[model samples]
Target: MKNTTIALLGATGKAGRYILKHLINRGYTVKALLRKPDGLDFRHPKLVIVPGDVRDAETVSDWTAGCTAVVSALGQTPGEPLVSALAARHVINAMQQHNIKRYIFLSGLTVDVQGDHKSEANQAKSNWMRQHYPDVVNDKQQAYQLLSQSTLEWTMIRLPWIEQTEQRRNLAINLHDCPGDVISTADLAAFIAQELSSATYVHKAPFVASI
Candidate 1:
């Protein structure tokens, strides 16, 4: 996927940072969209930092115009609802307007409304997430619903618990079941990078990471 211009939303967070590094190292032109694009000067030759919030439709639309694909690593913290949904809405609108069809979004495994036979631990965790972060999960579910119904070739990677570790190798990729107990951030980043070039999960919401 050399020369593919990827517009990455939330390009400064944990997973976003790893994705940026992998994209740069793999020689892909990156246009990083961030709410606060100050003080982050990776200074990589292949990186183009676009300083704007994803909530701004016009700004995101402009950035999406010339990009081959869009990757959203957007998330919601404890007390932020409007901001998170607004960003996701803007991303969807911009991609729609520009006719950019390939989108990969980072969502949680609990967003699965179907409740397919997941492990008991996963179910318990989902229950906990629903209790504590109900609004955030609901927002993500709304986002997933919108994306799933859209015409764009979108893939929502619903990941398990994410960890920051030095082990940076590709674990087994699965479509339905969780792959392992924990997923390293590096491995997740590598998976996203691989998906940029392949359609292993096109238009399919897959629960990822190692089981």
Candidate 2:
């Protein structure tokens, strides 16, 4: 693909790191949004490290400029205001203004997509999140709703517990159910990078896990 420039959110996180490397290795230019410049290790001619926060509209607008797509691996942390919903709103607005399409968002199983027939184990995990991390779960659910309402082509990838391994295991991709147990960070990044130009899950949410 020509001019494969992408605006990446959460580039400093565990999954985000793998995603940065994967996209770069796939010959795509990446504009990574970061709250701080600390701890980032990737440097390349195709990589543009933008220092900014996702919640700030001005920063997000700057990051999305001249980008063909957006990929988010954003996650909520304790004591921090759940910003994924707000960030999604900002991203969607920018994409509309800039006429950019194709967005890929990373979500967990707790945020159920429509027609989702979650397995017993997934249900238990969702229940646990409701009991413990209600704010985080609620924010993610709101974020997914925002994506669903957008006119842009978007895919929300619901992932299981992500391990920091280099294993590229087989990932079961399903539309309505949790597919497997756990997927490695390497495998998840590979899927995201490949899905950037794919229409398989456009306007849909797919649950992915290791089989």
Candidate 3:
């Protein structure tokens, strides 16, 4: 918290809000960029909300400038044009410019990369995405490509169906398969918060679900 300032995008979305709260409550200084600043309701001394869109390269660069690490909880919009890949490019370029080394990215399990060996059932999920939601899948895949090829240290936490229920369980993570079909937002937030300094999965993509 002392030296680790976080530059967060998608800070207003469902998962992003939880991630933001976790980081803020944990005493991390968070600089969050939102299209609508008022989307955030609470305030903390360490929380700074910046009004901007993630797709704008200059805005993302400026927002990311002084943060020690970047945490992107950005998600795809159903009818909106692709946003993740473009945003990732901007974030990566900014990280290089600012010398920020860590990037913790959250995405759906459908984003396939080279080292993944998901089980049949898990792989089916990605296949379905590609068949029906090609744009979203393609966008996330490009984002992964950007992350993997970038110089900054990165960890992409691929998630299953996200639930908002209070029901809690132990988190199950695997490099080659998804352990379950769903994960609570609470559990996902905790895992991401812990990953910031853990370095356990840096430069790797892991499938996560609640068990």
Top candidate, metric TM-score: 2
TM-score of each: 0.92, 0.97, 0.95
lDDT of all predictions:
0.79, 0.89, 0.87
lDDT of 1 by residue, 28-135 (tens): 899988667774657687888887867778998988878999988877755544455566678888988888889998987778745367778887888899998788
Candidate 1 lDDT for residue 85: 59
Clashing pairs in model 2, backbone N/Cα/C closer than 3 A: none
Clashing residue pairs for model 3: none
Ranking by lDDT: 2, 3, 1
Ranked by TM-score from best down, the candidates are 2, 3, 1
- The Cα RMSD in angstroms, rounded to one decimal, for candidate 3 relative to the true structure is 1.4
lDDT string, candidate 2, 1-211, tens digits: 4587999998888889999888988989999998887769778998899998888998899989999999999988668888989999999999998899999999998987769898888899999999998888898999999989989899999988889887788878999988887878988998998888689889999988877
Q: Point out where model 2 deviates above 4 Å.
A: none
By TM-score, the better pick of 1 and 3 is 3
Native RMSD of candidate 2 (Å): 1.0
How many steric clashes between backbone atoms does each model show? Answer: 6, 0, 0
Instruction: Please list the residue runs of candidate 3 whose C-alpha ends up more than 4 Å from where it truly belongs after superposition.
Output: none
User: Could you tell me how far off, in angstroms, the CA of residue 124 lies in candidate 2 after the best superposition?
Assistant: 0.7
Q: How many clashes would you count in candidate 3? A: 0
